[model samples]
Target: MTASPTLFTRIIAREIPSDIVYEDENYIAIRDIAPKAPVHLLVIPKNVSARLDEITDAEEMGRLWLTAVKVARQHAADYRLLINSGEKGGQVVFHTHIHILAGWENGPDSDT
Candidate 1:
């Protein structure tokens, strides 16, 4: 049988070392190692699920999305939320995650 992919799996397997900010039974919040903004962070669900569309149930989706928002607010007074889907959408990791970017104004020339 194929194995289910989880956000924590990569971290646990040491495939990637995230600047972890928070962790618990259900979720993990980590700083974006290659950040685009000053306060770029990623909030990931601990459970195994490949992508946002792969989420089989509604409750799980709610929990994951809400957790991302909560963690983002903790770091900045205000922030922008993002989630990349397929490869074309710029999702590098197979695991599902929400990116919380803030602490800098996104001007037209701001690429980072």
Candidate 2:
């Protein structure tokens, strides 16, 4: 039987609406629904790897980093690259993804 799709999979397929930042053959970058920083983007591979360790030596791995860097450069600002590998690692989505936090800003409940 075919495996079920993850949230990121649906997003990549355009089944669920997401603010798509960039996309190509192997990867797609989109704005995070729940923004952790002022500019939070999720760069994900189209190929389902589940987590970082799953595809360490894959060619797509390098592409993933390139894609993230490309997106980060667009902002021309300080940014942090994060990856939540497993469940306890704060990875709500099992699909491997790179989190681009471009800097702190007033969050929803912040005293701005």
lDDT leader: 2
What lDDT tens digits, residue by residue, belong to model 1 across residues 1-112? 9786454687845587778887778988888888888898888887766778999899999998888888987898878889998899998888888999888766424764
Pull out the clashing pairs in model 1.
36-112
Q: How far out, in Å, is residue 13 in model 2? A: 1.0
Q: Which residue pairs clash within candidate 2?
A: none
lDDT per residue (tens digit) for residues 10-112 in model 2:
9988899999888889889999988877788999999998899999676668888888999888863667889998899888899999999875555334532
Give the distance in Å from residue 51's predicted Cα in candidate 1 to where it truly belongs: 1.0
Measured by TM-score, how close is model 1 to the native structure? 0.82
For model 1, the stretches where C-alpha displacement exceeds 4 angstroms are 4-8, 12-16, 105-112
